[model samples]
Target: MKNILIFGAGSIGNHMTYASIKLGHKVYITDKNFAALERMKKKIYPKRYGKWNKNINQISNSNLNKLNIFFDLIIIGTPPKTHIELLNKCKKMFKYDKILIEKPLCSYLENYNKLENEKNLFCGYNHSVSQSFQKFLYLIEKEKKQKKIFISIKWQESFKGILGAHFWLKDEYDTYLGDISKGGGAIHEHSHGLHLAIYILKKLKIKNFDFNSNIFFKDMENKPTYDVASVLRFSNSKINLVLETDLLEDNPQKKIIFFNSKTKIIWHNSFTKNLDCIDYQNKKFKKKYNFKKNRSSEFEKEIYHILNIKNQNQYNNSPLNIKYSIEVMKKISRTLKNAKHF
Candidate 1:
C-alpha cells in the first residue's frame, strides 16, 4: 500500500482520511492541535464513517513528533491561511511523491506562486475531476458546432451546512471563513462554480473576456469582515456568463448552465445528498443524467484521479493542475478588487 499523509483533522481532513483508507492506503493524519486529532478519533470520524478506523494512524503535529516515514502522497487540507506554511513543512519532512493543497490555495494570493512550478503539486478542486463534469465535457465537444450565446453558474449555500457537518465550529466567525482577507468568503469558498465555468470556457477556446461583480459584505464591528454574497458577470466574443456565489441562501443551490435561445444544458449538484445531475434540452426534447453515491465516494473518485497520473506531462495537464487553479484564484482576486460592495 502506498503511504498517504494528510494534514489537519477538520471536516475536509476527515473526508480525505475516509477516502484514502477506502483506497487501501497506509494513511497517517495529523493536526497542529492535539485536541482536534482526539475529536477525529472520538467524535468526528466515527460519527460520519460509522466507526473509528484501526488502520489509520492519528498523530499530533509538532517539531518533537517528526514523522520518519516517506509518504507517497501528502494532502494539505487545512485552512487557506495555513496552506503555504504547512506545505513548506511537508517539504522538510520525509520525502513524498506528491502534494495536493485544498481549494483557494491561499488568501490574498500572497506567495501563491512560490511553489506553482513544483511539478508534483496539485490543487483539490474535486468537482473539476468529477465524472459528471467529464460527461459534460464530452457532450460539450459534441456541441462545438452549435452557436453558444450564454452560460451561467451558481453555488449558493448557507454556512449552516458547513457548521452542521463540522459541529465543532460555533459559526462562521469560529474559522477563517468569516474573514475575506483570509479567504473563507463566498467567492473563494464556492469558487468551484467559477472553476467549472472557466474550465468549459477554455475548452471552447475563449481567451479574452470582460469580468465584474456585485459583492455584498458582512461587516459586523470587531468581527471578521467577508463577502457574504457575490454575483459575477463575464463575457467574451462567443459567450456571456452570470456566476453567483453566496453564504446567505437557506436553500442550497449549485448548478451550471450553457444555453442559446433554443437549447440549454445544466449540471446540478445535491439534487439529493447522494446524487448529482445533468440536463440537456432543446426545442424537441430534454435528457437527464444522474450520478449517485455516498459523499465519501466523491473523494474516492478524486483520489483515484490523483493516483492515475502517469507522468509529468499528465500531471501538468490534469484537471487538478495548479496552473488552472491559479487562473481561477486570479479571477477571484480581481473580482474582489473591482467589485462594488453593499
Candidate 2:
C-alpha cells in the first residue's frame, strides 16, 4: 500500500481521501480548518473500505507534531491560490516521489515556475486521465491518419459552484459561477474540453493551430470573466467551442462533434452515465462508452496511474502538455479582454 498525504479537507480533498482509501492506499489528511477536519474524520470512518479502516489518519494543524513522516505520494487539493505555498512546504518536509495537484496548477505562471526543477510532479488535469476522453482520443487519432478533421463543442450547465453544483447535488446554488477571479469563469469551468482537444491534436502531431474565445459576464468584483465561444484553426482542421454556462441553461448538455471529409461523429452527454456517440456518413452508426460512474473513483484511478501502482497506456510529455494548457489560458485571457462588449 502506498502512503499518501492530502493537504486539504475541502470538497475535492474529501473526494481524494475517499478515493485513495478505496484503492487500498493509506491516506493522511491535513487541513488548517479544525472543524472541517473533524467533520471529514467522521465522514471518512463510515466510508472506509474493509481492512482499509486502519490505514486512515487525520493530522491537525499543530507545529509540535513531528515532521518525520515519509509518504510515497502527496496530493494537493487545496485552492489554486495556496498551491505554491503548499508545494514549498512539502519540498521542505518530505522528499515525495510523486505529487498530484489540481488544475490551473497555479493562479499565476510565475508560481508554477518555482517547481520547474522538481521531477515527478503531476498536475491533476483530470480530463487527461478520463477513460471516456482517452477513448475519444484513440478514435480521433485513428481517424486523423485518413483525412482532414474539424471539431466543435457546445457545452452548457447551470448553477456553477465548485464541486457543489454537480448533478449529484439536489439543490441549486450560484456561489462560484459569477466570481471571475475565483471561479475563473466559463473558460476554466470548460477548460478540460480544450485541454483534451489539445492533447488529441498534439498526439496526432498536428501543429499550426489558432484558438480564441469570446467572453460575457463578470462577478461583483468586476473581474472581467466570461461565458465564451472559442474557435480553433489548424492547417487541416477547424474547431468551434461554445460555452453557455451558469446564467443561461437550466439543464446542461455537453456535445462534441467531429467532422471530416467522409464522416461526422457526435458525442453528447445529458444526465447520463455513458456518453453517446453517433457517426453520420452514407449511413448512421451509433456507439456509447461507459465513462466510469463515480468521479471520486475515477480520480483515484488517475492517482494510482500517476503513482505507477496501476499501468496506463500513457504517452506524451506532461510538462509540454501543461504548457499547451497555459497557452490556451493566455489566449482565453486575451480573448476575454478583446470581447468586452459581449
For lDDT, the strongest prediction is: 1
Q: What stretches of model 2 exceed 4 Å from their correct place?
A: 43-54, 63-65, 108-118, 160-178, 219-247, 269-271, 274-286, 309-321, 337-342
Model 1 RMSD, rounded to 1 decimal: 1.9
User: Candidate 2, overall lDDT?
Assistant: 0.59
* Per-residue alpha-carbon lDDT of candidate 1 for residues 6-78, written as tens digits (9 for 90 to 100): 9989999999999999998989988889999999999999999899999998876664246788788899999
lDDT by residue (tens digit), candidate 2, 1-342 = 988998887667877887887788888888887886775565543453222355568788784146477788898887665776787788888757777777656553233544545556666777566655556666766776654566766555545433332333343223333344553455655665556566666777777755554455543353444453344333444433333333344456666677777666665543364333443342355555545346666677677667763222232355223465455455555555666632
Candidates' lDDT values, in order?
Answer: 0.83, 0.59
TM-score versus the correct structure, for each prediction: 0.95, 0.78
